[model samples]
Target chain A: MALTSEKLAEPVAAPALAEDTPSVAIRNLDLAFGSVKVLQNLNLDIRQGEFLVLLGSSGCGKSTLLNCIAGLLDVTGGQIFINERNVTWAEPSERGIGMVFQSYALYPQMSVRGNLSFGLKNQRLPKAEIEERVNRAAGILQIENLLDRKPAALSGGQRQRVAIGRALVRDVDVFLFDEPLSNLDAKLRSELRVEIKRLHQKLSNTMVYVTHDQIEALTLADRIAIMRGGVIQQLDAPQTIYNKPANLYVAGFIGSPSMSFLDAETVESGGTTALQVGARTVPLDGYEGEGPLAPGRKVVFGVRPEHIVVTDAADPAAHVTATVDLDEPMGSDSLLWLDMDGHKLSVRIASDANYAPGSTVGLSFDLSKSSIFDTQSELRL
Target chain B: MTDATATYTGPHGPKPKRRLSPTNIMLYGTLFVVAVYYLLPLYVMIVTSLKGMPEIRLGNVFAPPVEVTFEPWVKAWAEACTGINCDGLSRGFWNSVQILVPSVILSIAVASVNGYALANWKFKGSEVFFTILIFGAFIPYQVMIYPIVILLREAGEGISAVTGTNFRLMGSIWGLVIVHTIFGMPILTLLFRNYFTSVPEELFKAARVDGAGFWGIYFRIMLPMSLPIFVVAIILQVTGIWNDFLFGVIYTKPDTYPMTVQLNNIVNSVQGVKEYNVNMAATLLTGLVPLVIYFVSGKLFVRGIAAGAVKG
Candidate 1:
């Protein structure tokens, strides 16, 4: 949370874009395979020198949208613009973008150097220039020692570096990566992820990355577009999306040890707004929203595990009393699952604070960091 | 307790297998029988070709020649008669060479490009085209022989009418080469298509994004990685065109008859003294080209065909 908060501060302190033209734009894009619509009327704008990540679970059309932007999949309708040009019908190569695939996709017959230079040779680039570019990309990726080795001789991480170098040698203005690190083990994935972020800082080219991993979306993206069922549910800076999700789905999808919910009804007594959960009345003094909460509205009170605190003293007016059901001790912290009159809720606490089963505890909700959602619309109130 | 301890030994894997186990006996015994069955004819052909005519008449066919002579090989190469020509199988050998080289090259080149296009650069009617081409593979050559003959005859007549010259494919070496090439296309195309299909689609997509068009991708990427399949195609075409007898007899006349047809004529001429040695020598010569090719590239052939068997 501290790391995320620090990153959240820097972008706000920075100035806005000097020019508003997006490096890549999609307008009413639609893609279909025969009768099955994979994407429909989707629109996105990627700013210059920005790293935009399309994040979702599997079959969420995030990869499909990235493919459309890369000019790999032909859109069934609408247009795509790159650098202000209408490149709806342009070939992938002509779109001024370089793409890395999940499988590394290096030519198995060619050495690493050959894999980087094959496309340039096809373009008929001057030999000296091709050599220089290949050398520079190899140096940047730190794969110069592997230049003579074929792809089969390299390990998974080294092969991926070669793949990125292949894209780097193209020297295009935009890069599209499709789960490029998913093939590696966890340690290498994190190492490569940092390198990719460093590469973005050095080159400052627009990048559109597609992945199903939420952590990758959180750490690397300037803006994250969360997609579900061919539609973008939310798009915002990672911190904004994490703290103030626009809908119930976004709130639930963003966090690990996901947010806990309590079924409640809003109450207004003497101009003071509050929520009634079972037998307890929780005050809504610090709850921030677009407008005042209406009385008698059925709503879901959502609070993340880390936002709930367990206290020893039970003050019925301020805290909900619950019995601990189980505690899972993760290395850094433990999640305490509690049963409050048959409603299950989880609270995050330090690993040293072990809670035995059936022990009573008072749970204090952080109202400022919690979300209240309308039951019918599923939107945050 | 003592018996159990005696049998236990230390914890280890199963006992080492006996060399002469029942399974090994059955496997090697069957393989040895099949090997002998296949090699017996070749052994007979070699022994029969080395025997003098007098030795063959006086002894059993299986016996080694009491008097070995190379006269039959020389006669098969220079003195044997086919139809009315005293010239031996050398002329037919040259004709077969001319037909085999062009046909193998043309068929493999065209079919590989066809496979590359069908597998990667798919167009509007590509699947339909592929279905039709694969359909052609199942039709028997015997059923299409007369129709092909008529087609070649008509082509020759049309060319003659246009050029006012005696241009004919009906009795020429080129005619047989075309026939061999056409016959070889279906199976060779299938082999190449299956191989290229197994190449990762991402590699093809990466190449397309890297500014490589069809030929560029083929030569720089697909072609180089496809050496095994190319070797497969070459072996298939070489063997098919080299051993062909029907097309050689039907498409070309005496001056351009292929080695197989010449071998047939020498064996069943119905006029000579039935020189079994000479007949065996001619048969061995006719079969030598494909045998030599198979032996030289035998390992690559297995590797190539096995590429399509298991896909990652």
Candidate 2:
């Protein structure tokens, strides 16, 4: 083994809270439906002007958490504070927040202008003031030409824009969005994703977005709260969450095609630490320290498909050989299904590097950014 | 580009003239037969009502009258007799109006609110009560009439005992209105409940977040959006209350009889020669209200009742 003197960096914990007052503060909140607890002891603090995303699969309490913050669902226990006021028992409207729904929820009978102005008119605001706010919102959302058209006349993208405009006209400090782009097609979802990012940049209002789409969560969120079974598995910045996940679940869920896990044992030889898989030993020089590494410790080593480099046969670090079983050409990158030591592994490499099937290739593992989970505890170590 | 070449192409490949397919012919033939079957009674009624009494007796029911006259319609509307009163169904017609306008309005108002509550503000035991109410719709009105009558009589008696005024609801239009409202509640509430339930729950949530209260949401959102269902409910109740003979007979005195009861009495009276033309005219007149309502609300009635068949 060639020893490289690389100091293992410490994995960063949760980022420090910003100095500004929190825009929305959720205390030890709990929500239960009869015998089923949907969320338990959940605490989240959203900073002013920050884009926070709550992400999970369906029935994972992400949308339920958004509803609780919006005051659409009554919390069974604990308090919700928006703008430093306890709004736990307040009505959804009085909570000083606006919301956009996945279904758009535009009144079918009303025109786009009517939909945007209905709430303001209900507050008995003056006609000119309502017009001014509505016009500004329509201009901001680029829906001025659609003012007179009913919801049925507009397409899905236009309807969502109107929904966003409805929230915009309210001129509130915080906005809650519940899977607003899930109804759109893939092209429209990406288009609206950018518009929403632009909206956050322009308006600079604190937003709480809920979605199950990991791409949207990664692209749009300043911090992502990955939830599972009503419990938040990890909460951190996108880069940190992507680079150093808190547990095996986060690691598996965050990547497309999922990360590959290999049963390995930590081995130490000549003051060098490494992981042994079958007959090959890979260096652990770049792994960030979670706890003390010891010899003969069992672990499940994980590596993302993109991080497994197909190395030249003559490279000194190339210790493993795999046969390419199949190739999925995805335009810019190709995913190769390989068999290494009787384990199927996916390797995403540049599409131009055409590795034909049935060909043998040498592989080098990038251990610096890999994950190692304790076998017993299933947590990052 | 030459005219002769264009003409040659057009003559060589002329478009085929449109023709109806066998499927279209079969479908239209079935529809025509069904239409005639439904219109037969209406044709007989209209033809019979236009004839003199002698002509109706002389000819078969299907034959159009050789000599038509307006005398039956005039007598039916103004002078036909029910018991000692010769003032005709005009009295009962006006009585129907009095009972109808109030009954329709009151029943729809109460049932809609009840449905709204059952749909959105579901409290404890609400579903139990709504289920019982909907099941009550299947029970025949006759089975429960006696109990309802006794209940109303006792209620009136209780009021009179306290107020010293004999509040007699047994023979009043107000009594008929109350009875109609009670009977109409089950079906109307079901119709409105299903319709309100079909409304996207998100809209209700959006309205709540828009600062709308209970009545505000109802008037501004639910009521406006549910106009079709309301039209359906109105069409239902108007025909039901207008054509009711049994309830009118049991609940009202002879003087306050509705058009249906009065029409029945005038036709079936034992003392006079059977004026078949006059009976047909009176029947046609009594049936006019609902026919008008159905005709006016033609497409909406079809659309409204099918409201919750597909989720929006």
Candidate 3:
């Protein structure tokens, strides 16, 4: 990774970006609270200088997993490795990992100067060295002028910066953020997200972040780990998770307006593979969805909301008839709700889509981009 | 003045509405009457104090005096009678200060330590300890006094042996101070516990992640955050101990009696001249510490109690 101040953050496609070495690796991790199991046999690998996002809903054990790695929580089973050294039983400070809590957790009584310098002071560093580190962190977070202000006097974004600066001053090997941007307003979240990315690039620190918003996971994660029910659904580059999702869960979870699903049995109508939805068999051309599928056994067909297109000039064999239930115009794209085979589905159409409530419309799926899933396991077919 | 006054600031450039009608006038007037009723004792005290022995003999208890003098304030300070002693309330005042100062200071500091630990440090049996300690507060002092006396007697003799003299805490100023502190601990600790609990857990977590250990969190974060509550605790503890009669009576030697005990002896002496002026003056003087506290902290009472109860 090269640093160029002239073109600081262009979000360039990384062709030469190495598969960086694992800075953190958790093996066969199990976390439990009394009789309830939260994380069961979880394995994770975070590479050096890589921004890894743990994407999940609340109580899905994303924050718990990060806490285990941060040494703020204990692992009941697995071993945690930071830079190839086992840190399963190590104290938090000894692990050299910095965590930004969801609340920002800035000390209210302490000035920004005091908050950032607290760690160094606790570590019993020399006064001059502490001052130097504080100054450097302040510069990095661009909070030099606000250093004298109390946390109450600072805005959410400024307080968040001070929190980041507190971590930066420690110069830790890994930085863990547990929903850092969740507290900020929409505008501030985006601004701080960019700042965090720049910070990571400049420091080249391996960072593992947790957030519920899929957009955040997509934008900031070099590699996103989509999780469900305390299990990692997929771990891949953002586009890979978007395009070639490993399972039905990942496919549905990654995209906004979500991917739609229908259980249908595979049949051959003419030379093309067709799905028998109730009594009508819909055509699926170039359907090479490769997973276990017994002919006549129910399997699922999936199409993203954006993939469903409505057209006036329709081919009867190629498209299905849909009655629009509701429509939402979202700037460039409009979402249309329609009923098909007793299931209500949403279609993301162009904002100029000449459709209205209760209107009969013809819908087509780009079957080449469609995915099939085994109904029982919900895995990609 | 009360009705027109408003704390609201708005776009109307402060044209505070005058909503005080006849009903409001009657309400305010009745409140003024009630306030004077509470002040009646103080007014009688001042009137009686200004009267001489001759006027007092008339026994017109509510009558204003023809002549006024500052003799009682002077006499109470340096010449009022104690049993077999008319040396005045002046002599016992220093003893009161000595007993009161250390008792208040020591109790407050100890209470803070207990409060911080009970509130923040969640360990095994910590809740049980807190529950039992709070339950201890509900126990009648009279029920526990006998056992406490026995413990003090045994402990005092043991100390006297070690010091090579007939020494004991049974009737010492130190004993009284310790007793006040232990009794005061439950309430003070309760105040501080509630106070510390309301402080955002975020502050504590931030300190810990920044390499703060237990002592670090307490001193650097919890202590600084608990200052307002600490002030209130000190005020409450001071007033409670200063006004304490039974504890001071039972625990202290005659030479070490606090203001309350001395005032009691001078006012309630058997066959003693009922010098209403001196009694009232002494009590008013004795009530002065809490009165001053109430005045100083009156406005901030709500804030001082509920300062950090909610997140900002």
Candidate 4:
């Protein structure tokens, strides 16, 4: 099977704690819509100047969490703190947070300059300073030429940049973005994604971004909070999330051509436990060595597709041998689909190799980076 | 910079260009027929207004006048009488303007307020108040005139102590203005409410986050979006209040009666032989303000409001 390389990283189990105050902290937050509980006991703390991204599938309460932080919603239970202030009961304006909506919520009647200066006007800023900030933000976004145009006159990308520019002019402590690049096309989405990261780097304020796109979350976030069913399954740096996912759900998420899983058992050899799949055994390596793993437990083998190597010549008694079913060669990286037993697995191949679709290739499973997980809880062992 | 202008094809492709066919022609023909059916009465009113009483009595209502004369126009404008005042339809013109102006202003103002409250703010009686207001709108104007007349009499007598008999609101121009404003309410609120609801919740959120208070959002965001719908609201209120007959007759004094009230009196004057030509002219002339408004701003009038405030 073809394998793609993944960057190694230290554990990012918790966010970086600053000596100063946290920008936003929500404690034991619970929210419900009608009768449905959307967020259950969500505890989150974001440090100042950290670009935190809520990475999850749709309906996973990422946007809900952003709204909660922005004071746009009332929690069913719990309090929210912004810049060390208890802002749970406060109105959105009092929160001192600026938000960029997915729909680019620029006022249609207002010009680009008006949009950037709108918040400042509301705060009763001086006319000169308002113009200065608007000009500066427009310059940063490269929308100075279009300042006189209404939102309807601007393109989708221009509108989003203006939305961001509006938030930038606020010059507040926190910047919250709810999938700001979603309205733009793929090319625009990537370009705006870079712009947001650069903006975050420049502004150095606490930023919380929400997106279902893993690529955006992975590239833009300082630390990614992977959510599922209103609960944060794992919150870690992107490298940690990609290399060592906290659980099966996280392993399944966070990576393109996702990590392949094989139902396995823990087999001991010389006081070391190796994960046993069908007719194959692989080392548990760093995880098994670090944590005390019980023998004979049903463990799931988790290995990234990027780590799987599809070779013509194979060494005897390799980790796992699976027949390659399909191969897709992307420009920078290729994807290889392998069928092991009944489960069809995806393997990320880093090169555009001239490989046929149904070639029966041997697999040398990379043991140093494999994950062993408990079958019942799906937690990494 | 290279990727800035790159475009991706959207989900659905562009639609095929349209071409008119025979079925389209048939549909348009049917629409034309329906339009003529609606406009036939207006045609008769004009045709009969220009004809002499002899020609009108000949019963060719659809036929054009043989000798088109504007003598009836002069008579309707200058010589019709209402209880010894022979100042014609012009007698009620000033009173009608007074009633129409104030009623339109007051009703438009109240509707904007009610629409703002009902759409965004949800106080205790908000929904119930809206329900009652809408119900009042749908209720026939005839059903409302009784309570209104009684209320006006009580109110006028209360104020008569100060202004004496002449300035009494019961049978004066002010009474009719109040009646027209009250009648204008239901539809105005409903129109603004529906229009406001269509606006994105995100726009409201942006405004709120921008530190705009309750009234601020309504005025700055909601009111500024008064486009197409403003035209709609004005036209609806203008037509309804302008063509108002029952309220004008019931509430107004004999001296302060509007053109519709005078038009009715002229047709039913029963002073020897009824002057049909002058009656027809007066009827058409009384309808002139709205008709001219429609002709001039007809596109906007058909748009349903007086102002195009909610431009997209």
Taken over the whole model, the C-alpha lDDT of each candidate is 0.88, 0.88, 0.80, 0.81
Residue A356 accuracy (lDDT) in model 4: 70
Q: Give the clashing residue pairs of candidate 2, or none.
A: none
| Superposed model 4: Cα runs more than 4 Å off | A1-18, A288-290, A312-314, A350-359, B1-41, B54-67, B122-133, B140-143, B153-172, B301-312
Inter-residue clash pairs, candidate 3: A289-A381
Q: In CAPRI terms, where does candidate 1 land?
A: medium
Which parts of model 1 are misplaced by more than 4 Å? A1-19, B1-14, B310-312
Residue-level lDDT of model 3, residues A1-381, one tens digit each, is: 222421232222112323665899877778888678888777677888889999988888999898898787768887899998999998777788888987888877889999899989989999999999999999988899998999999999998998899889998989999899999999999999999988888998999999999989999999998777777777789987776666887888778888878778887667655688755677766655664344566787888887777866355744677778898889988888888767777898778866767777777787767788778777677
| Model 3 lDDT per residue over B124-161, tens place | 68778877887878999999787877777888899888
Scored by TM against the true chain B, the candidates give 0.93, 0.90, 0.87, 0.81
**Chain A TM-scores of all predicted models:** 0.93, 0.93, 0.89, 0.91
Q: Best by TM-score, which number? A: 1
lDDT at position A317, candidate 2? 80
Model 1 chain A poorest 10 in a row by lDDT: A9-18
* TM-score of each model, paired residue for residue: 0.93, 0.92, 0.89, 0.87
Candidate 4: tens digits of C-alpha lDDT, residues A50-76: 899998999999999998888777889
Candidate achieving higher lDDT, 1 or 3: 1
What DockQ results for candidate 1? Answer: 0.74
lDDT of 4 by residue, B1-312 (tens): 658667766755777655577888899999999999989988888888898888888999899999998888899899987778999988787778878888888888888778777777667688788889889867887787788889988888877766675446778888888887777778788878777766777888788788888888877777777767777767677777788888888888788888788888888987778887888889888888887777777775555453433332
